[model samples]
Target: MAASPSRRDRTLSAHHRKKQPEQVRRALLDCAAQIAAEQGASAITIQAVAERAGVTKGGLLHHFDSKQALLAAVFEDLLDKMDQEIDRTLADDPASRGRFTRAYVRACFSDRLLGDRSLWGALSVAIVSEPALRALWSAWLDGRMARHAETDGDQRLVAVRLAADGVWLADMMEKDGGLKRYPQDFEVVLLAMAEGGN
Candidate 1:
């Protein structure tokens, strides 16, 4: 039997109604990121994000209890995004290679990691300004580095890892400001270094 027109409309409407809150929450997060990028942390108030997101202040509060909560959510979301990219890049490694280190290097150089400077800038600010957040970030990176470290070649692992960081930093500086890029051949040199010449 065919559904009545009003019943069909009601089913679609109900589905959209269920999605409304999630849509609003996403909008609020996007507004928060934009504010952090464009105006820095001081500008990312609940009222500001709500207005930017076309929602009431109460609507924002429903998703985030406070400004700190909101910023933490934004920071964590960016980190999750970064981790996913690193894992995805890591998955393609071959068996007979410096798998972990190469994956780490490739992950650093990925567009996923290079994405959205405003989000990166905001998270960087948070990490630098908050001691707890700084400690947490340090622990996470230290764990990754430890896992990638070669048991018999700690110095080589550190060297290649640092080279990857150097490459990532240079790339960010060039895009974030007007910092001059390294010579065009530098990335090739950096990746070769990551290969550990094995």
Candidate 2:
């Protein structure tokens, strides 16, 4: 039996409504990131984010109570996704220190991460505006670096860590010209260092 048009429409509409919350949340975050990327994090107000996301202010507030909370969520989201991608990248060669360093660098520079500069900008502002948030971010990076050091040792890991930070900073600042020469050259040097080159 063929389904009536009204019934088919209702079924699809119900499915859409069921999926709307997640979609709205994603939209809100995307909009917030755009605002942060375009005008810096200080410009990301709830109203502005809502407008950018094509949602009402009430709808935005329904998902996030305040700007601080939203910023926290954004940072958390970026970190969590990065962690997952790194984990997946390292899964096959867990014991290869060189592979781990390469995977880490690739993840940092990947299109997925680079495309979310707003999240980076927001995190930067959060660090200055909220000391605790900064501390947490520091702790997270320190722990990751310590793990890298444990695996790759002080010398190689130090260079890798510094390079990672430099790459991220250059990208966030849109200083591509200044950083253009480093990606290939730095990776070669870093890989050699990781492999105990002189």
Instruction: Please list the C-alpha lDDT of all candidates, in the order they appear.
Output: 0.66, 0.68
**Which digits, one per residue and each the tens of the lDDT, describe model 2 over residues 1-198?**
996669677656655675579889988887886777777777889989987886678888999999987776676667778788887877866456655566676665565234445456445655667865776678877777677655655566667757876766665555454356455456565555556411
Backbone clashes for every candidate come to: 0, 0
Q: Give the top-scoring candidate (lDDT).
A: 2
At residue 182, candidate 2 shows an lDDT of 54
- Worst 10-residue lDDT window, candidate 2: 112-121
How do the predictions measure up, each by TM-score? 0.67, 0.67
Considering only N, C-alpha and C atoms within 3 Å, which residue pairs clash in candidate 2?
none
